[model samples]
Target: MTLSNLNGVPGREDAVREYVQQQLGGLVDDLRVDALGNLIAFRAGRDAPNGKVKERVMLSAHMDEIGFLVRYIDERGFLRLQPLGGFDPRNLFARNVTVQTRGGTLPGVLTPGGRPIHISNPEDRSKVPELRAFFVDLGLDAAAVRQQVRVGDMVTLDQQARRMGDLVVGKALDDRASVFMQLEVLRQLTGPPRHDLYAVFSTQEEVGLRGAVTAAYSVQPTIGIGLDVTLAVDTPGVEADEAVTRMGEGIGIKVYDSSMISTRWLVDEFVDLAEQAGVAYQLEVLSQGGTDGAAIQGSRSGVPTLTLSLPTRYIHSVTEAVHVSDLEAGVALLLAYLK
Candidate 1:
């Protein structure tokens, strides 16, 4: 919940780093913030053959989420924004948001530059606004807002994490759910890992897999696992075949995505591990989107990599949802493989 609240757009991940370090500082062998703002934590393995660590395994979950960056503040105290990542524009209508300023957080509402429905013609009422048409109303005078808010301040959706029966719903759960899963894996891991472990809370993935590329090159691990969220389009009006994953089914062992295909050997190894461990698992092949594993796999001379995704509904929106059981299964499978 704390992680999901932080404003971690592409270049704005300081709050996430601070929160991660504070929570995980004492648990790992070494913790450091890299030049690209990736938080790297190491845990030495004690179960190596010949008492020497043979392989280094990297685990990554991006900390950044889709957000808006303040661009132009008009004289009317309305704030214009440039998106830091993808937004549907349909979700930008009269939504509550928080602007992270140097002085303090300011509350605001996002509204598209359009006529009110009551005052609009039929043609105007049917037209959807473009991304550029959106602006934030801070409810303050132009001069007062200028004094407190600056250009490049990140604006994130105002939504609190909540449990809804079998699911958890919130904004920024696209990756923070995985971030929390990583932290839980760290806490619940019982014995020393078989390979030296590098758990990296990566930055700037919502923009592109930027931090993952840099961190993967620096670590140069033999194996990498990218933790992320995948579409769970199982709701009404969507066909079963079109649904990439079903919520509460199990952990997703990704086979392919638009970015990268899983290493065949690595996929086989994970399947074997899941079967042996008696963990519920699913084979995922996302036809459209990508994850940090693509960057990790393409780094240096290239490393074997795959992603484990949590099935999420309404991605890139304020009301994203994830099944608690599926989340736990993802953590369990990854933890077992790491062990």
Candidate 2:
């Protein structure tokens, strides 16, 4: 199986799911994709060296990324889009994008319709570009475009994963980076698990924790750990207090998000394990956005839920950045917890 790049870059989940299944092989005792298309991977405690029986543990990372969906094609052959996830209009203008159409993937650039900067006055510059004002140009005529693309086709920003100094940058790193960590944890995990383990790769996380809600109810694990990306506004931010985390620090032990408040014991356990394992970490309390942990926490009878996050910069944009050290820290903590 090849690598799956399901970072909402269009048609990524199928590849990711296939790669995971192949990697698990005989190790995965059970695997199933739900109606919502969440890939559930199961491995047992008995498979470990100690073979001690333990309750189920759920680990999840969202597979969805914020992107555009083709909604309308005007007579001029420009395609209008509807956002599949939250996006800042400021980031949309003059950005390159890839459109997945009926014919194939078409490369294009998204630009807002307005006067060029050279001709525009300062007042025009001050005007914020509404999302609806943007359109993608594929350099094709109307007939050609209509034949190649269709409404509801997927569109993703043209971004590539690359090493930027000590960090990785690309779109969808908000969760794709977390997904990579979860896979690494599964791969490098040598210790015996104490309980039935379910590693869930969920969908539609960008819009809300919708996929997680259903997946958690199905697994009903005693504990749930939502793997995600937290803030790293270490850049030239307006203020430092708002920066929830620091890049290269380590995994983030999330204290709060809009959707869920982490269980105290679970958060403490993560903290202790990180310390004992010599894993670098930071405490996070995000004032905005949430992850799958909330859905798992709201599951039947309420599961003790926590989140481990990789610190990220430029979230929901074309070039989300995450430090390698932070991802390593997440793996370290997760491995320690499994032990």
Candidate 3:
């Protein structure tokens, strides 16, 4: 429950920025909100590395989550949505939602148009609706909804973070879990860092890594570490080889994904450090996803970059799950590496 549950779309990350800043308090040497809504926190090291000028180390985690924005309100008070990030149409059905309006937040139910089981034919029962076919029912008159909600208002899944056994599940776990890791690391951190540390809660990462692209250019770090969630298809129906990572295994030292390949030396160094620190870890090669590391790797003249991924299941859905032991292992590895 300590994890932040605020709603943030790709381009709109103001609330998330504020929440991170509030959590940081006076722990950081400098904290600022960038033009692109990235929350950049600086922590200076005590001594330069090997007597040379210290290099900056960038640790990034995106704060944005997949959600929808209101595009139109029909005459019957049904809200049409434009997705802000990738979504599987099959998972979005009869979901409770919160519409963030200018006036106030409104409760609604997201339901795709389809025949009920009682009156449905065999084809209707088996049919799957497209993402565009879904509508939000606010149970209000069209005129009243129009007066309160604007076209660009955000809508997020209505769910609370919960603990089940050793696993935590809820909406927005994709990046918020990483955010919580950053927060816990900052809290337990004691002395100066080895390099100038910049913890960036980047925005618009779900859309196209927009915030990280700009933040990396501005920071021009010597090392970039992307902290995000990776696929954990350790459940039923998934092939053993296709399970990129397994839940509760440990932290994932990402080697390659769709966006970028990790710097080999850095990957090796992290593996060595994890062994030295006795932290549980796994090497991951995601087949089809990218993280902030790609943006940082492509930044001005490039930087040595890698990703530390937390294995997560059911990503981009309300029921995303992450293991507590894996989360702790990720924090332990990060702390060890920073030391």
Candidate 4:
């Protein structure tokens, strides 16, 4: 839920990983990271029946989101940035942002690189700002700004989390919500899964699904489930057909996405379980965006894979919204799947 807090916190993924580790420390059998920097945690399965090598279950939630870095410092103490992820130009005016410097955090607002409004023309106003046209003002001189912020300083939006009834509204929830869900499942597991369970918190999903490629190769799970958030376009502007899913609905069973096509048999089994358990659920066919399952499914010999997603709204924005009830359903469905 610390989307704003995590923005611009690129490569500082270890900090988030450490936070998760501390949160689940005593409960997990082991907690560590793969060479590619994914947060890997192990919760041994209930004393493997007959002492067999337990089957593995890989769970992943991306810890990264779009953000920016300090690209240039201007004479007037303004800061230029290089975007780390896709950013919409329409939403880049006078918005508060965080300049995460090496020394300390400095708060600032983003505005286009331009002259005073007194001399600006109507056409200039019509021209929506470009990502390159924006600059962050940290309220400091050029030398002081340079001293505090480095070339690659992380910068995230300042829209802190807000409560929307039982739902949570914040940035980076695109997948952290799933990260929380995974831990909650482990908390409820009480024992190991039917097979070996490997909870893998992946990295660089927004960029290229990099962490999972290495992780899938290493873990080799027979079945992989990418736990993440999916678009729930229940709001205005989007037509019913254009919307991928809806709010307050159950977990999304990914049939296919740009990255991979989940096995037909596995998808059917998930639906069956959801129905039998009376858990609210729905089918999904994402137009784009992929999860860790894709990477794992193709790794090595090939493994059956699927995505278990929490229905989220305003994805990739400073405020990703998800109903609390839906999040709970996602956890329950995963538990049912594991059993």
Error of 4 at 12 (Å): 2.2
> How far is 17's C-alpha from truth in model 2 (Å)?
3.0
Off by over 4 Å in 1: 50-53
Q: Candidate 3: global Cα-lDDT?
A: 0.90
RMSD of each: 1.4, 2.6, 1.2, 2.3
| lDDT of each residue in 1-339, candidate 4, tens digit only | 653245524465665676677778776788878887888887766656675756688888877777788898877778899887667877667889888777878989888877657999998877887899899988788888877888878787778888888789987787778888988888888766776688987777776788888888887788888988888898898899877888888888888788889889989999999999988987888898878788888889899888887888888787788888888889999898776
lDDT of 4 at 55: 65
| Positional deviation of residue 232's Cα in model 3 after best superposition, in angstroms | 0.5
- Give candidate 3 misplaced runs (Cα > 4 Å): 2-4, 49-53
Off-target runs (Cα >4 Å) in candidate 4 are 2-8, 47-54, 115-119
lDDT of 3 by residue, 1-339 (tens): 444378788877768777888999978999988899999999897686475877799999999999999998888879999998899988888899999988878999998887778999998878888888899999899888988988999998877889988999988888999999998888878888777899999999999999999999888899999999999999999899999999999999999999999999999999999999999999999999899999999999889999999999999888899999999999999889776
Judge candidate 2 at residue 47 and give its lDDT: 55
When summed lDDT is taken over every stretch of 10 residues in candidate 3, the lowest stretch is: 1-10
TM-scores for all candidates? 0.97, 0.93, 0.97, 0.93
What digit string (tens of lDDT, one per residue) describes model 2 on residues 1-339?
012134353223555566666766765668999988788988776453455447789999987778888999999899999887778898887898888876778989999998999999999999989999999999999999988998988888876677789988887787878878888888887645656789998878877788888899899898899998887898883488988899988889999999899999989888888888899989999998889999999899999999987899988887788898998889888888885
Clashing pairs in 4: 8-155, 45-192, 46-192, 55-196, 56-196
Q: Name the better of 2 and 4 by TM-score.
A: 2
**Model 1 vs. true fold: TM:** 0.97
- Give the number of colliding residue pairs in candidate 1: 0
RMSD of 2: 2.6
